[model samples]
Target: MDHALIEASLGELTAANSRELERKCEQIALSYIAQLVEPQFDVDSADFARDPRLICADRYWNLRFQAAPTLATAVDCAGWMAEHVVAAVQDPIREKWAMGYAFITRNSVESAAEIADATADVVAADDSACNKAYFAALYHAGKLRANFFYDELEIFLAASPLALAAGPHRESVLFTALRAFAAFGSRTTVHQHGCALLDQMWNSAERTFAATDVVLNGLAAGKDFDGRAQLLRDRSAEAVAAYPGRDILHFRLATGRWMCGEYDAAMADIDEALRLLPAIGWRVSHELLQGQYLARRDAIEAARAADRQARIDRDRVQSTEREVDRLAGEVRGTVLRAVELVTVFAAVIAFAVGSLNVSLNGNITLADRIWIVVTQGVGLLLFAFLILGGSWFIADRLARRSERRDRPED
Candidate 1:
């Protein structure tokens, strides 16, 4: 409501109570008590003798009447009654929370002290399950409401807090609206747990970044889990193949597959990397890598053979271009490796020349001879790797093949 209208209403409420107004206040209190408790019995009429809620609620209103001296105070008691009754009736998890509310508000002083004690005992002293639940609900209510606030603050920063206060107040009201709710009993606890997990979040980023994903098939928000994982695996494989020397890429790809929960494929990458371990020059491995593939034991081998063909649909799609690129990478890697080997040979030849005293060549010092050798070695080594040395690989392969053919069968 606008400020002026609200101001006028407040002025009317403070007027002295006449006989008519006092009777109205009594009616108002009775009406609220009926609405709160009668609904559960599914009766139009309240049986004061039979219903405990009606007994508690009615007594609560009378207690307010006895305590309140001013007419406005009586009206305020009527309001407080309405709040509790409505709380019980309107709750989604109604009946229970509402009944608790009514029972607690049955006496104001008792409730105030109960709240204070429960707040300290349940929160500080560690109370029973029920009291702790009240505290948990309170904490969740406050935290979730604050989370909601942090979200809206990004956009509607200009709006008053009341704009968003209506919602998220159903279960709680940033703990403020607990007065609107009815809290009944308090509990005393013995001990509390130390190491416990509360929940697992799909997105650690927390603010609408709901999940992790590799880009291609679908976002993490989509229902296509398999599709997202397939894309992630394919991208990882492509990356690994393109840079085979980065053997750690195998471990990384496996990690992504593991996240996808594709156990076999993840282990396949690791197993394959283990077989293709770097040469002695690399010196990386001192132990075994994780093999998730071996997780499928002999028992599963039977199941796999039976279902393997049927599981064709589960295989990740391999694009033609990606495969072709992988092959091209292999070709380039072979050429690179050969060039590296030739460069080593050239360094060895230079070393050998440095060790010799080349007196035959105009009595040149070893230093001058080494420099001459290095200058020629670089150019010839470059040629040996590919320009003139392409034939070397062909000859070597042929010689190996001839030797294999000539050997006796083992």
Candidate 2:
């Protein structure tokens, strides 16, 4: 194996993307596997590990497993790669080999546990580079099955600060740290630790925009429970500026703005993201956010209309009450006037009867006097009935009019 050829091949593999890369990686791994089985090629020699292409091939196979459509297929490929290739890899590269194995074996508790044990051994050896690789592998393995490895993840995070001090591993260490915090950190600690980690990355001149996006995106997904939408918006804005033309970053920024109640700005950002990549998912997201903002605006308007109507109804009810009180007062005055007239009429009738009795007392015979008294009594009774009945009719008419006026509108 020529070293220059291996370097060129690995360089090509790194550059290729999509289906072409997959095909090239597969061909390379199979060719290596064929060589391993050949009788002439010594599998146990240092020459086997000397060619960096073997490690590169291992990485390609890992990529192939990751791209597998189903977990079962991925696991099968991972198992095959571990048995045929990874097990034969020499010591220094074995940590990377183990990390690849752990990544694909995540769905299986048994296989994953084996990888974890291997990772622990690598970590115990205290090789800075190897431990970094091991921790990265551990993080990837636990990422998909966090519930199974929560305790181990916590312990790893506890040692992250010291491990991250070595500049070569800082990026990988930071990535694992973000994932660990997102998965296991408390709501209070998630934002605190996440922001602190992000700040470190941002301040580090060596950090790449791509690396910064990873932490930002991870924090966005995990820290949703914190309700610090404004914080998300601010950080996402920074990310957008740091990584221009990354549509995903713009999308995330839009989401943050939406959460912060800046709908118009959010929509503008969403539109820009869509312009960059007009996928159906982004369109759907755009419509959903638009609908929410419109719904909220409509709800506010409806509430205002309802409140205004309530005020109008209250004023109308007060006016009606005032009118009813005035009608009641008029009724009282009418009743009092009727009472005064009746009293005066009764006094006049009483005085007339007394004078008639006195005039008849000396000049009239007994029969005549009796006739006069009977006739006068009947006349007085009729007069009194007429006066009282007329007063009652007027009062009843006024009371009925007041009731009609006071009746509520339908």
Candidate 3:
């Protein structure tokens, strides 16, 4: 395949409807698999690692797996990465493969455990904090999905100090540790530990409010929301002062005020946020908040309208389902009738064949026998085609009926 064509197809794949995208991806993947299975294709070559087609194929498969996480895709992709990409590559590419493997296997405990076990030697020997932290983050992510792998989480946490000592990965290690603690640590202790880590990270010489925002977001979702609003408010004010004109800080402040039941203040901040960042999503969110505020003010009218709309929507859905079921039943009946006709036709053909054999006997001319066979064969084939065609016609009619029924009234 031409690289430009492949790239264009990939772009189209991204923009295609979900059903069409799945079909396109399957076609692309099969093409890649064909290429991969060719005897001349060098799976171990550096050139293969750098090949654009191979890279695109890898990305396509990864996207498919990410879109729908399944054991089969995970196993296949992991195997391909390990054998065809990782094994053939060096340094940065190899590191990416390791990280990719960890990410792809995060949902499967067995796969993740295998990865940790396989890379233990390298992870132990490597003194780079960034690499260790990267690996630890991967394991920590896996631990989140697989509750039985607390040991993996512990191992990563143990390596945190090494990551902290090395400056490059200090923040990453801390964030990963915070995530682990939030996930598995005792609720009472986890919050305190997270807060301490949050403080340490924020108060460091090179302070990152963005990172602090991440930790605070996690904390906001926790059980202890009593003082979190105040904490968020203080942080939001500080961040705003530090990074003036940042819409996100205003959004953060709005979230804090919303949580604190200060709707007016929250709306005010949301307005500012919207003014700074006039995104459709933000507008939708603002409108939703406004609706909520309105509902709070006029509960009775809002509830009545909501109940009426719910009933209308429910009845519409039920009606559509009934229509679909009716159409499906008709299709099934048509199919059954077609089957019966085919069966009857088969019996008639069998009877005719037997009768012809008896009448013709061994004395029949070779040309006559050939003619009879050909005519009977053609007749049976034509009848089979008619049966199939009739069934499809019924199905098509039913589908058209369904589409007409489903179309919304203007």
Candidate 4:
């Protein structure tokens, strides 16, 4: 548990030198694995893979789970996101919640409902407290209801005449008016129904757009943060156009613009948004947004600097390694020359010994000499193979380790 020990263990995992080192490295890896086992973190395995094909961000995917514009694309995108979510959720009960969510996103509401029911059955089967799961489900259901609610109202409003003199259903007028009670000072009555319904629909859309703006603004302000941001952008843009001069609407548009890489426009909108936010007390969210925006910009700059340094380090390492290899090759040549001299001297001594007792040497037999020759040849071949194999393995491992070290984290 010592901090230095853990740090050293992590270092070994990155550059292990022996089997024992590797075993220790594996133990260090398990420490991180233990973190994954915690239910809250929901770490996804596939997402950690080097190359994850990502679907381009779309607004609807944040919602009542609208499909991508094309059928095939929707399947591909939703499936990828679902896989990541499932991998992230380790708990069986919670994992199913993730699955239900992914299914709802890719399929029809009926299909989504079936998935949700199945997820509930799985949770119930465990006989565990699923109060959290139940609440999560309820909250999402409410959002989904809200998402569709305005769409329905919009349709109803379209059919209704501008003036009540045209005559629509009393029930529709009554319900719409009830929903609008807070927005417009008075409820819609048959007597003053003409303009009230239209006002109600506009007010409803404006409120929906405002709520959407908060969520999206939070998301856009965070680097690599996805979800609801695009939806906020689309909905708030519409709201701004529909209800001009609601300063926050313009602010939301500018924030969305900033998130999408339109920095100039975003600055313009933030200028306006800041002026209006004082009254609404939305400065906290705006402050967080500005902080995140600055942080990401700083991160980008830091990453570029780190990348340049890594390239320089890699070049220096390769140059040093080449120098060492060249020196080693020169030394190898000197060793070969020394070995050749020794072999020549040994052969001379053997020949001289044989000549002193030619018949006795003949009696010693050609097979003996051939045996000596064969043993030397085999020994030399074995030595060569061992040297080459060991060097190759060590060099390959070092090269791979160096490459990994030199690679940028992001």
Regions of model 1 farther than 4 Å from truth: 1-38, 42-196, 199-410
List the candidate numbers ranked by TM-score, top first.
2, 3, 4, 1
- Estimate the TM-score of every prediction: 0.17, 0.42, 0.37, 0.27
Winner of 1 and 4 under lDDT: 4
Best-performing candidate as measured by TM-score: 2
Model 4: per-residue lDDT, tens digit, 1-410? 35455554444443333344434534544453345321112123331111111100111122223322222222332233334445333233232222223334422323334434534443443322132333233223323333343333233333322112113222332234322321222122221232344344445532333333333333333223243345445655776776566555676676566445555555666566556543321112345444544554454445556666887998998788777766765665566556656565655565555445543555567787666556655665566556556655765666566567546688
Clashes of 4: 3
lDDT of 3: 0.52
lDDT of 1 by residue, 327-396 (tens): 6556756775776676668656754664443535877777887777676666555655564356556646
> Model 2 reaches what TM-score against the true structure?
0.42
Q: Which stretches of candidate 3 lie over 4 Å from their true place?
A: 1-112, 121-139, 142-185, 188-190, 205-210, 240-252, 268-410
Error (Å) of candidate 3 at residue 16 is 19
List of clashing residue pairs for candidate 4: 42-88, 43-88, 164-194
- CA-only RMSD, every prediction: 26.0, 15.7, 30.9, 29.0
Off by over 4 Å in 4: 1-226, 237-247, 256-265, 271-363, 404-410
Clashing pairs in 2: none
lDDT values, one for every candidate: 0.37, 0.52, 0.52, 0.40
